[model samples]
Target chain A: MDSRVWDNRAWLFVVPVMAFVLFSSLIPMMTVVNYSFQDSMGQNSFFWNGPGWFQNLLDPTTAVGARFQGALLRNFAFSFTVLAIEIPLGIAVALCIPKSGWRVGAVLVAIALPLLIPYNVVGTIWQLFSRTDIGLLGVALGRSGVPFNVTQNAGSAWAVIVLMDVWHWTSMVALLCYAGLKAIPDAYYQAARIDGANRWSVFRNIELPKLRKVLVIAMLLRFMGSFMIYTEPFTVTGGGPGEDTSFLSIDLVKMALGQVDLGNAAAYSLVYNLITLTVCWMFFTYTTHADSKDVA
Target chain B: MLDRIGLKRGDEVHIADASLELHAGSMNVLLGPTLSGKTTLMRLMAGLDRPTSGRLVEDGRDVTGLGVKHRSVAMVYQQFVNYPTLSVYENIASPLRVQGLPKAEIESRVARAAKLMRLEPMLKRTPAQLSGGQQQRTALARALVKQAKLVLLDEPLANLDYKLREELREELPRIFAETGAILVYATTEPAEALLLRGSTATLREGRITQVGPSAALYREPGNLDAARVFSDPPLNELALTVSNGVAALADGSRLPGDGALGALPDGAATLGFRADAAAAAVAVGGDGRDPSHPAFPGTVAVTEISGSESFVHIATDAGLGTLVCLVEGVHAFEPGDRAEARLDLARAFAFGADGRRIAARPAAAPRREPVPA
Candidate 1:
């Protein structure tokens, strides 16, 4: 048997990317780590606090600790709600798209239009669109005799945020599922039909199973995006009528930039990053493991 | 009664005016070249596609507008299509489950199909874990479990390797025999059509050129296209002239037309014969000067030895083009070697200019000892 020659020359191609990432991500992350344990008093003066902020942040008796706890729970709730709404709705939309026709491209483009908009622009658009005096949705809801105000009510704020998120990002999930659906050979559908499978059976056995990989990726991306969401909610309802819709990312920005508590904010950022990474890794591991079990 | 079954997409016609009657409990082979509408015809029969203008009648009932879901048909595609995520057992039981059959009945049927396809060992594994042939067997088992009245196999073995193809080909007929369903198999390979040994419908350019028993179609093709479709190495066609009920070749050799000429006006015609009907030999010591067999003098162009038989291609000196002859065992005739190829007139076919066979020569009498010339 011939063994492969070990050549260090291949590392030459990867060095540039490594250097770029080192400056772009790793160094900034290290900065956050450095700031997490140190207290800063204006004018670049710093003193090592050594986990004092972490202790305060973990103790719910304090005001900052209570805010962090509330924000963390709200972030988990938001991510779960977004996933629950988007996955099934995206699948339904993908299934509704015509498999083959002159209009397939047109429909796909229409569904993907929202995803092309900037995240801040999406937030701004929904913000205006939900104004009670001028915006169509708010005006329509007002004239229809319903008490709907995202600016003042936490429930309505959450509803509008979830709706905006679904409108803006469900298309990504749908497009992924559509691509997965198209990759399935026509023979599979033909075989299902020949087997006397009904519409539900075909969707369950053929389409759903085929879309598993794409759905996993979609779920992971959506979860991470929603967990780290700031721009959209910050622009739409400014993190709520109170602290109701302020997710962990918004709370981190508030703690670091609003109150200038760099040490506590940095600690919160690390914890936030850790939770997101841990959840995403768990999702990836579970899906790939389940996929392997299917093959075995 | 499928009257004028045709499918046209925009300006191009896929299947045009093709009509067929598929009998139950009989295997029918759709023999054609690539893009010959064989798959289109199978799809129409399986209710996978609607014909532009035709009515499909089954057991005296018209099922023209019926979709595949309502039709009692099972199809095995060229690609072994199975639910990749489901185990072989689930794949085979899917159709039964869709029909809401009892668990016991579904299990028994799935087991039986698995046994028939020799897939019992791999039933617990998914398609991704199985080899190509095993995956195809799983697909076949799924189709078999349905036990539909019409079973359509659209070049199911075309994607398999030679050994796997041969193994599955041998088992398929036996598997379908027990179902007693009307089996319609489509293939582009003529050898496969012959191996299946079923009634064949030859397709050409979206048209049903001929339909008959496989052996009869092979021995006496209805037209030139059918003959070409049914031949492996292809038939040797030569332009010849007929005069006084005798077809004469360019080399001054004549074959007695007798009753085989079929009242043709003496004129130019085409004669075709298989490679096996002709024998090539080096003329030595007057060995090949047989009076009964017409001989053409030629130079050996190429020789191919394939196991038990050899194919000798000879270029005639009379500008009659090259003729291929299949001889038993090996012949030591290299290129440029002088040789004579004797044509067996009994197996020759005469065709008119319109590409329709005018006559088929009768099988020759049993060979007698060569008399002295």
Candidate 2:
């Protein structure tokens, strides 16, 4: 048996990353933890609240608790909706892209264009692009006799938000899935053909299973990205048409910056972060477990 | 008929006018070197790719326009492409599942194929957990479970180790024989072609040069390319002068004209000799010179000894460059040793300027010459 040499010297290479994380992440996180338990009055004077904010935030009777529950439920619904539409749409687009040719590069560049735009820029672009009179989509829908006013209608507001998110981020999922699809050897496709498998059968047996790992990653990224969505909806909808599209991040910002409720916002932040982390961890664990069972 | 069928990528032809009739229940080999269109021809036959011009007719039905999914064909690739996420059982049952076969029937067929490939123990394991040979076996089992009318194995044993290749090669024919599919096996190794002993079709440079029984093609290749394809270690070719019913070597030795050479027009020709033929002549006549047969003196350039056989490379003065002679057991011929190899004119092949074999020579007698110890 070969024994590994004990080398303390290798730890030196890790020191820079550890120091960066300490300054960038741990310090800020500790500040949020400290703020979650204390109430701040004028002139930065503070008194211990001792979980008062957490208890009120957890309850549904108070205004803060009610807002938290509404935002949390809306966030879950929005995340599930985005995943439902984007994952399949991304897979379909990925499958439709040609396997080889000069067109592959052109198509990939076109798909990746939306992802390169800044979040606020994407929101501003969509905001102008969906206006009732001048915006192309709204004007076209109005000309076609459809009642489409994102500024006044809750359904229209949700529609525009979901549509904008899908248009901006589905390409990310497609690119990830395309990378996974490209890794499969041509031999697999050839073998599938020779096995007399139909198109659906081929996709079901070969392509989908091959894309499972990439799908998990796409799901987690899209879930977290859509759950914490603020700038796009805030810029385009302004959490408006009566707080219809206000997700958790937008509500958190409203409570902390707009209402100046520092203690409650801090508690909300910790709870929100915990919820996202827990859900993502569960998804990761489930997928990895399924993958291990497959190999076994 | 693949009358005008060819494959061209941009401007270059991959397989040009490749037409052949394959029979059912007999293994046919597409034997060629690398990039010689063997796999292309197999793909065309299996309906995986359409010919640019020609149509494929199977049992009097034109299948050129039909896709692979519409055809009754199965294939085993060189890379052992099993579904990585699926167990061996599901991989084998995949085609049946596509057909929507009854679950019980699919299970029984999978079990049968698994038993035939000796993969019953690993039925529940995924391809990633299996060895290379086991993965190939899983692929073979998948192909067998389909029981398609046509089976194309594209160098299936090429990626396997030596012993595993030998073992699988022995079992391949037995497995296919029971399925009654028209099996088309492709390989670059001449020894593999000979071992499979199928009706071999020799291909070269996107053209089917010759088609015949494997042993017959080995014994009488139709052209220079076919001879090269069927020969291992390559046949030794010599540029010689034929004048007045006699072939004269560069070393000034003359071989009397047989019936085949008697009809030649007395000009330059190519002489082809297998390694074993050269060794036989060298073994019987130690001095590498025999009066009754054409012989030449040469120095050994290189020697390779493998197990019970030794291949001695000889650089002859006959303007024939180097010739490799496979001597049986062991010989004491080292590099730079002076040796002579006699040519049995009757057993040798002659090609004209166009590289087509001149069939004028009578078949040689099967008598072994005595070693004059």
| Recovered fraction of real interface contacts per model | 0.73, 0.67
Q: Can you tell me which runs of candidate 2 are displaced by over 4 Å? A: A1-10, A42-53, A142-147, A283-296, B1-11, B52-71, B82-111, B119-135, B234-306, B310-350, B359-373
DockQ, 0 to 1 scale, candidate 1: 0.41
Q: Which stretches of candidate 1 lie over 4 Å from their true place?
A: A1-10, A290-296, B1-4, B8-11, B67-70, B84-87, B97-104, B121-126, B234-350, B362-373
* Model 1 chain B worst lDDT window (10 residues): B364-373
Grade the docking of candidate 2. acceptable
Against the true structure, what is every candidate's RMSD?
Answer: 5.3, 5.3
| TM-score between candidate 1 chain A and the true chain A | 0.92
- Model 2, B150-207: lDDT tens digits are 9999999999999999999998987897888888999999998888887888999999
